[model samples]
Target: MRILQIHNFYKQAGGEDTVFEQEAQLLRAHGHTVEQLTFSNNDVTSTKAKLQAALGVVYNPQSAGIISQSIKRFKPDVVHVHNFFPLVSPGVFWVCRKYKVPVVMTLHNYRLLCPSAVLYYDGRVQLENVQQTFPIKPILQGVYRGSKIETASVVLATGVHKLLGTWREKVSKFIALTPGAADLFQNSSLRLRPEQLSIKPNFTADPGLGAATREAYFLYLGRLTEEKGIRTLLKAHSIKPFPLKIIGTGPLQALVEEYAAKNPLVEYLGFRPREEAMEQLKRARALIFPSEWLETFGMTAVEAFATGTPVIASNIGGGAYIVQHQQNGLHFSPADAQELASQVGLLEQLPDLAKKLGQHARQSYEQHYTPEANYARLLQIYGQAIGATEKPASATVAAEAGL
Candidate 1:
C-alpha cells in the first residue's frame, strides 16, 4: 500500500508525534511505500508569521494547493493525518476530497470537540463546549495559551469546519485512540457518525520486562501541569507514605521543586532522556498517574506495562481503560489525594499483589500493545477507508454509463 502521512507538530513533542513516527515506520518496515508532509508550530515564531497563521488557521489556500499537488503526484491509497491544528488546518481534508483520495485522521486529542484540545479547564473536565455551536467559552476564558485572540483562531477553525461538513464528509474515517475518546465525540454535538469512527489504542515497542521484584521507589512520568493532577500528586506525597520520583518539567516546576525540598521521600529528577526514563520504568515498583483530565490515551501507562511495571492511575478517561483495576493495575478516584495516598499504602502492604499485577500488565502489553498487533489493525482500518472511498467512485462511473 502507498501511504501519504500528514502532520503538524506541536511546540513541545508529545505522544501524538511519537505515534505518527511509529506507525509510519511500522508501515515502511512492512514494505509499504510511505511519504510524509509535515509542518511545525515552532515555525510560527515571528509576529508576521503568527498573524498569517491566525488568518489561515480556519482554511489555508497555500496548504491546500501543496496537499493537492502531493495527492496528484503520489496517488496514495490512503492519506493518514496525525494532527492539523493551527498550521495545517482542516483544509487538507478538503484537498483529499478534491483529489478523490481516502483520508484517515487519528483523534489524538479532543481538538475537534474543544478549543483547548484537551477537554480540561480550571483543573477539571470542561464539557461546556460539547453543546455550544460556537466555542466562545474557551475563547472568552483564554483557554488556548491564555490569549483570547489565539483561542479564537482554533474556535473559528473548528466552527467553520463544522459548517462546511469537513469532518462529517470530507474525511473518510476517524481513528479514536480509545473507546472512551470515541464515546466522548459520539455523545457530543458533533456530526460524526458511528460508522465513521474506529477505536485504536496507541502502542509502544516492548522494553523487556523487569525483575520480579522492583526497587523501593514508585514513579511519576509526565508534564507537571495542573490538569495532570500535579498539585494533587504533591498533596498525596506530603504524607510521605512511599518514595516517589518525578520525571518531567512543566509550568509547575517551582511547586514540584519546593515539595521535593520539604519532603525527604519525594524526589524530582527533572526531564530525563527517553532511554533513561525507560530504564527507570524497568526499575520502579509502579507508575503513578494522577491525571484529572480524560487523557486521549496514556502512553506512559502503556510504557509501564511494557516494562512489567503496574500502573496506579486515576479511574477516569483513557487511564481507566488502560489500567484495569485489580487485573493489570489499580485505580483511584480522579483527583482525591487521600484515595491516591491510600492506593500507595495498599501497594506497600500487598507487595505480592503488586508483583502479580506487574506480571499481568506485561501479559496485557504482549496481547494488545505489541507492534505486530497494532500493524495488523492499522492495515485493516486503511483497507476500510480505501474501500469506502472506491465504492462511491465505482457508483459514479456506473451512473455515467447508465448501467
Candidate 2:
C-alpha cells in the first residue's frame, strides 16, 4: 500500500508525534510505501505570525493546495492524517475529497469536539461541553491557553468544518485510540456512526522483559501536569510506605521538587531518555497512572506493560479499560489520593500478587499492543478506507477542473 501520512507536530513533541512516526515506520517495515506532509507549530512566532496562524487555523488554502498537488504526484492508495490542528487545518480534508482519495483520520485527541483538545477544563474532564453542539462554555471561560481568542479560533474552525460536513463526508473513516474514545465520538453531537469509527491503540517497540527481581519504588512516567493528577500523587506521599520516582517535567515541576525536598519517599528524576525511562519501568513494582482527564490513550501505561510492569491507574477514561483491576493491574478512583495510596499498600503487602499482575501485563502487551498485531489491524483499516463505496464522482470532477 502507498500511504500519504499527514501530521502537524506540536511545538513540544508528544506521544501523538511519536505514534505518527512509529506507525509510518511500521508500515514501511511491512513493505508499504509511506510519504509525509508535515507541519510544525514552532513556526508560529511574533504578533503578526500568531494572528495569521490563528486565521489559518480556521482554513489554510496553502495547505489545501499542497495536499491537492501531493495527491496528483504521489497517487497514494490511502491518505492517513494523524493531526491537522493549528498548522494544517481541515482544509486538507476538502482537498482529499476533491482528489477522490480515501482519508483515514486518527482521533489522537478530542480536537474535533473540544477546543481545548484534551476534553478537559477547570481542572476536570469536560464531558458537559462535549455533549453540547457548540462548545460555548470553553470559549467563554477561555479554556485553550486561558485565552478566549485562542479558544474561539479553535471553536470557530471546528464549527465551520462541522457545518460543511467535513467529518461526515470528506473523511472515509475515523480511528479512535480506544473503544472509550470511539464511544465518545459516537455519543457526541458530531454523531459519527458506528461504521464510521474504528478503534486502534498506540503500540510501543517491545523493550523485552525485566528481571524477575523488581525494585522497591513505584514509577510515574509522564508529564507532571495538573490533569495528570500530579497534585493527587503528591498528596498521597503523606502516607507513603514505599518510594516513588517521577520521571518527567511540566508545570508541576517545582511542586514535585518542593515535595521531594521535604519528603524522603519521593524522588523527582526529571526528564530522562526513552532507554532510561524503559529501564526504570522494567524494574519498578508498578506504574502509577493517576490522570484525571479522559485520556485518548495513555502510551506510558502500554510502555510499562511492554516492560513487564503492571499499572495502577485511575478507574476512569480509556486507561481504565487497559488496566483490568486485580488481573493485569489495579484501578483507583480518579484524583483520590487515599485510594491510590491504599492500592500501593496492597501491592507492597502481596509481592506474589504484584509479580503475577506484572506477568499478566506482559502477556497483555504481547496479545494486544505488539507491532505484529498493530500492522495487521492498520492494513485492515486502510483496506476499509480504500473500499469505501460512498465516495461521489462530483468530488473527483471538482478536482479535475481545479474547483
Candidate 3:
C-alpha cells in the first residue's frame, strides 16, 4: 500500500515531528510505500519571511498548492496528515479531498480548538478567554513579548476553523492520543463521525542509547517554558530534600537560571544533544514532567519509559495518560510546588517503591509503546484505512463494467 504523510514542522522540533518520523519508519519497515510531503517553518529567518509565516498563521496559498501537487504526484491510498499549523493550513487537507483520498489527521495538540495550542494562557490553563472570577483578559494580553497581532491570529484562526467546519470536512479520521482528548471534542459541538475518532498514542524509537540506569538526582527534560510548570519544579527543588537537575531550553531559561543561582539542590544543564538527553534520562532517579496544560502526549515521559525510568508527571489532561498515578509512575498537582515536593520526597524515602515503579514503567513501554508493538499497531490502522478506500474503488470500477 502507498501512503502519503503530510506535515508542517514548527520552528523547533517537537513531539509531532517525532510521531511523523516514527510512523513513516514503521510503515516502511512493514514494507508499505510511504512518501512524506513536509514543509518547514524554520527557514523563515528574515523579517519578511517571518511576516509571510505570520500571514500563513491564518492561511498559505503556496503551501496549499504544494500539498495539492504532492497528492497528484503520490496518488496514495491514505494521506496521514500529522501537523498543518501556521504554515500548511487545514487547506492542505482539501488537496487530498480533491483527489478523493482518505485523510487521517492526528490532533497532536489542541491547535484546532484552542489558540495557545496547549490551552494555557497567562500562567494558568485558561478554559476560556476571560477569567471566571476576576474577568481578566489573559487571552488578549499575550504571554511573551506581547504581540497582539500574533495572539489575535492564533485565537481567530482557531475560532474561524471550528466555525467554518474545517476539521469536520477535511478529516476522514481524527486520531487522538488518549480517550480523554477524544472525549473533550465529543462533549463539545465539535463533531467527527463516531467511529472516525480513535485514540492512538505516540510510539518509542529503538534508542541506540539503550536502557537508563537509576541515579541519585531526578531529571527534568523538555522545554523550560512557564506552562511546563518550570517555576513550580524549581520551587519544589528548593524545598525538596533530594537534588534535581534540569535539561532543555526555552523562554523561561532566565527564570530557571535565576532559581538555579539561589538554590544548591537544582542543577541547570541547559540544552543537550538527544544522545546526551537520553543518557541523562537513563541515569536519573526519575523524569519530572510538571506541565500545567493538556499536553497531547508526554513524549519525554515515554522516552524515559524506554529507559526504564519512572516519571513523576502532572495529573492533568494528557500528562495523566502517561503516568498512571503510582502504578507505573507517580503524579503531582500541575503547578503545586508543595505537592510535587511531597511526591519527590516519597520517591527519595522509598527506593523499593521507585524501583518497582521503574520496572512497571519499562514493562508498560515494552507492552504498548515499543517500536515493534507500535509497528504492528501502525500496520493494522494502515490496513484498515487503505482497505476501506480500496473497496469503494474496486466496486465502482466493477459496476462501471456491469460485472
For 122-207, candidate 1 gives per-residue lDDT tens digits of: 77798888766577878989999999988888888888888877888888778888878887787776687666777778899987
Task: Tell me the tens digit of each residue's lDDT in model 3 across 137-256.
Answer: 534576423776676676665556666676666566677777777776555445554545666778888563334346779999989887898888888876765688889899899998
Provide the overall lDDT of each model, using Cα atoms, as 2-decimal numbers. Answer: 0.87, 0.86, 0.76
Alpha carbon lDDT at 37, candidate 3:
87
TM-score of each: 0.96, 0.95, 0.88
Which lDDT value does model 3 have at 394? Answer: 43
Clashes of 1: 0
Off by over 4 Å in 3: 45-59, 129-139, 143-145, 208-213, 386-403
By lDDT, the better pick of 1 and 3 is: 1
lDDT of 1: 0.87
Q: Supply the global lDDT for candidate 3.
A: 0.76
Superposed on all Cα atoms, the candidates' RMSDs to the truth, in angstroms, are: 4.3, 4.8, 5.6
| Candidates in descending TM-score order | 1, 2, 3
